[model samples]
Target: MKPLDDQQQACRDWFEGLRTRICDEFEAIEREAGSGASFEFIPWERTDEDGTPGGGGVRGQMAGKIFEKVGVNVSTVGGRFSEEFAASIPGAEDDPSFFATGISLVAHMANPHVPAVHMNTRFLCTTKRWFGGGADLNPPIPYADDTADFHAAMRAACDAHDPEHYPRFSKWADDYFYIPHRKVHRGVGGIFYDHLDSEGEAWDANFAFTRDVGRAFLDIFPAIVRRRMAMPFTDADKARQLEWRGRYAEFNLVYDRGTLFGLKTGGNIDAILMSLPPVATWA
Candidate 1:
């Protein structure tokens, strides 16, 4: 594995910082809910095919009064992609060597009334570099208000970058987050975009947009959580949430690109699977 350059290091640092901020905010919520729970950070290492040090990351997780299971992970890793997989990734067509740094979080609320959510943003470099990711809402008991607010936050983030972004990416999310076999949308869409390749002087521009996406999430999601976390839920609601979680598990295991990327790159198994809910039921 090659050493990360200045730009790569900057991305790594920013992702780690975001991870800390997210975990802190989540822990605060747990405290506010009168739970003493806090994030437990688990460190993991990664290595290249030759068994040389590649990179590693910490997975921060907590189960408490508010959040049933939440995972915020940040990793920076570099190595060559498998030949078969290399063909699918942009720029890796010619050379499979790559570097990636990112933060990924998924929260499954204890209260069925509270919506679960997923957010991730990553910077990857092969022969080229680009940024990708977005956030989406997953409410088993759908709430129009929460869906609108989540999309609104995402829209504001996109507008700051480019007016065209929201529409383009919202459609992308709708398209990407669907489960064809189940014939159901994963959740009310927010935004999902990729291959925002740095086209000469676009790195800073893209990075700024990515940062705003993270900030938008930080600003919006917790408020939504707090709003619904304390709402009363019955056994039926809990059952619905578990069934929805089953769909979530299917999507992650079968189709999530992040999961595939982590697995292919020799990522930490526990961290990669940390997105799975603590319990899920199929109906």
Candidate 2:
């Protein structure tokens, strides 16, 4: 595989910048709670099967009084996908080699009333190139107002580029973030989309949209966290949060494409599995 081109580097830089800002904001949140916690950064490298330099990434993680557990990571990697996985990825059917850059984040709140959230966006190139990712809310104890606010932010981000985005992507999230065996949704959906192929001007448009999605998340989620983080919680609420986290665990381990992709590409195991909650319970 060849080195990243100018456009690829631009995308990678944006993702890394987002990661830095997010980590800083999260650390501020911890400080406000009178907790001395802050993200511990760990750096790691990637190598292709033949031991060629593939890229690497930094993982930032923190467990604080209010935020419980959160991970924000940015990575740039390129190499040939495993033969079996190549058959499944778009554009990789003909050429298994691919380049990918993105930021991924998952936050699990200490207060059950405060929602757990996930957001990620990426630019990928194989025989073709595209952008894919979205954000969703997962509250153990559902609150109508919070759900509405989250959707509103996502909708505004979508509406900026194309009016059709919210409806299309929100429904896509409803379908994608589902647990088939349990016959239940993973959470209240925000937006989920993938394989947004970049054709001609589409690259610029899609890249702009992807950046807005990140901005929307950075804007709204902290507000939601602040609103609920100080609220009281009972034993029952904590129990529900644990049970809900089990479902989250199941979805990531069994169905998350990002997890599979990372593992297949020989990504850092700790960084890839950082999405899992710090603790969870089945019953």
Candidate 3:
């Protein structure tokens, strides 16, 4: 594997550390639910087009009484983008070389009352460098209070850095996470941002904001999980959750950029697809 520069190494470390914290917190929730489940971490590698080693990462997964399925992945990968793909990526058209590090997570709860969630943050470098990611809540059975709490946490994270962030990124999420064909949204919107240039000395603030987003997610999500994980649900509720999961699956497989990026860059199939719920029903 190629040695990462200082910025790359620093971002990579944070992403990995966040993964550890999230996995531990999730395991604790499982224990509280009277399950002894822990995350099974599988390390995987990536190869560049020329067969050179690209950096890889751990895919941490767990199944428990509360969280039916969850995956938290951290990856630091560097390689040259394909010529066809280069033009679409910022700063990659001239030089297809790039590096990216981030954490991506998705949780599917066993109980319908508990909301499913997604959180991700990434730093990518080409001729330019930038940070991007966001968190969104997906509840099969929506609760006004839970949705308010989740958005409040995300807003706090965004407001801490810049007042403009919450409104801008929240709208971005609403636009980005929509299912055009279905004429509906995938979930309650959060925030989505990209091309947050990390050029020059802008790294510190941008990186700090990214860290804050992760921290906000860590702070809020587990609390929500605890609140609803033990709630009783009927077969009708289970059916609703499964049917909603089908929509989740369709979005990931079709419109999710991270999914396409992972596939195009030769990321581990299971890790890339882990965002898909374990069981989903159509029709």
CA-only RMSD, every prediction: 0.8, 0.8, 0.7
Per-residue lDDT, model 3, residue 106, is 97
The weakest ten consecutive residues by lDDT in model 2 span: 1-10
The number of the candidate with the highest lDDT is 2
The window of 10 residues in a row where model 3 has the poorest summed lDDT is 1-10
Give the lowest summed-lDDT range of ten residues in model 1.
1-10
* lDDT score, candidate 3, position 264: 91
lDDT of 2 at 220: 95
TM-score of each: 0.98, 0.98, 0.99
- Residues 166-225, model 2: lDDT tens digits: 999999999999999899999999998899989789999999999999999999999999
lDDT of 3 by residue, 1-283 (tens): 6689899999999999999999999999999989999999999999999999998988999988999999999998989999999999999999999899999999999999999999999999999999999999999999998999999999999999999999999999999999999998999988999999988778999999999999999999999999988888999999999999999999999999999999998899999999999999999
lDDT score for candidate 2 against the true structure: 0.95
lDDT of 3 at 201: 75
* Runs with alpha carbons beyond 4 Å of true place in candidate 2: none
Clashing pairs in 1: none
- The Cα error of candidate 1 at residue 153, in Å, is 0.4
Off by over 4 Å in 3: none
**How large an RMSD does model 2 have?**
0.8
How far residue 150's Cα lies from its native spot in candidate 2, in Å, is 0.4
